[model samples]
Target: MTTALLLAVVVLGAALQRVSGMGFALVVGPLLVLLVGPVDGVLLVNLCGLLFSLLMLATTRGAVDWRRLALLAPSALVGIVPGALLLAAVSAPVLEIVVGVLVMAGMSAALLARHAPALDGRFAPVVAGAVSGAMSVTAGTSGPALAVYAVASRWDPRSFAATAQPYFVMVAAGSVTVKLLLTDARLPALGAWGYGGIAAGCVVGLFVGRALAGRLSPGRTRAVLVVVAFAGGLATAVRGVASL
Candidate 1:
């Protein structure tokens, strides 16, 4: 049952990610934490997310904005260290609470700041990248920070979507690497068949996303994403408190 649920969550997440260039973690992170334990769940999210992003990047590469990727990728590299350390130090229940709180807070901020004025200058991407990197490593959800940046910078939606893939790739890779090196955390032993299912889920999701691209509006998709994320976060937080 847990494996089945995990596959469903991954499929849903990857589809949403294809549609928005983000939201895989928003949809999958908290729920996975519930299905598995917090640490293994987050590690699985990073690993799966890396694979999904790599696949998406191949299709979106033509539309990518190199300038944005250049600004965001390296700073993200610098920010994962502390995140890995935090993961190492925290207890599972505490980490669950942290994950829940961060997800809720990040999503709220992104929703509220959608109409904010354009944020120009060099520091914007730098800050966003660093925050995103830390969040990605800590919670396996980097979209909110980058979402805020995309809106503030008045980025072209298509380009933002495309550019985000490579950025996600970098952040997820760095996150997994640092976590392995600096922390003792390991992914739950999802065997070859389990991993194969995850990969297939991503592929199916991308196909579904393409099919739905014409019929579904971005607004509706985002609305659903926010709702799912908020619910998952609330549930995880409540579970953490009860456990504590």
Candidate 2:
């Protein structure tokens, strides 16, 4: 039953992610934590996230902005090690609340600043990359940060998705590596089997999202993003209140 639930989360989360280029962790993390323990849930999510990102990397290869990504890669890589260390030290509840508040605030600010000047400065990518790396470790939600940076840069959807894919893949890889180094939790045999199911779901979800993307007018997409962002914030707040 637990495995089935996890699989469902993966399917639904991946569908959301395919449409938005983010939101998988936002949707999946809480439910997975409820089904499994927090630590195991995070580990499993990281593993699946890596796989999903890799798949995106392949599918969107021709569309990525190589120059922009190159500017960010160095700082992102440098930031991940320290980020991993921090994640090892922080409590999950604290991390969740912090992440939740930040996502909500960032998305709200972005929405309000729809007419604001684009962040075209050369240093923007470095700053965004560093923040993304740290957040990925601390909260398991690098999507919001990446979204902010991508939107500011004015990337078309395909370019945005492709450029953001590697960062997520790297973050997941960092999380898994750190977890393996710090803990003795054996990768369950069942988890391996579960991956197949999640992978299948992701493929189907991606196709569905791509097909639906054209039908969603810009206003509709923005509306959905607003709701998802609010939901993410609410989820985090609930966890925080429960912890308190």
TM-scores, all candidates, are 0.83, 0.85
Q: Over the stretch 1-244, how does candidate 1's per-residue lDDT look in tens digits? A: 7667767877888888877778787677776667567767787888888999999888889989898788899988887877677767776557657767866786677667768766788899998888788777766777766766665566766677678889988898898888778876687777886787789889988788657655766566555445655765675567668778
- Summarize candidate 2's per-residue lDDT along 1-244 as a digit string, tens digits: 6667766777777767666667777777887556566667667667777787787677667877888888776776676677666666776677767867876787677667778887787798887787677666666666666676665555565566566678678777876776677654334454565667778867766677667766876556655555665676667666866775
Clashing pairs in 2: none
Whole-model Cα lDDT of every candidate shown, in order? 0.76, 0.69
lDDT at residue 169 of model 2 (Cα atoms):
83
Number of the top candidate by lDDT? Answer: 1
User: Where in model 1 is the C-alpha error above 4 Å?
Assistant: 90-116, 216-243
Report the Cα lDDT for residue 43, model 1: 79
Which regions of candidate 2 are displaced past 4 Å? 182-193, 217-230
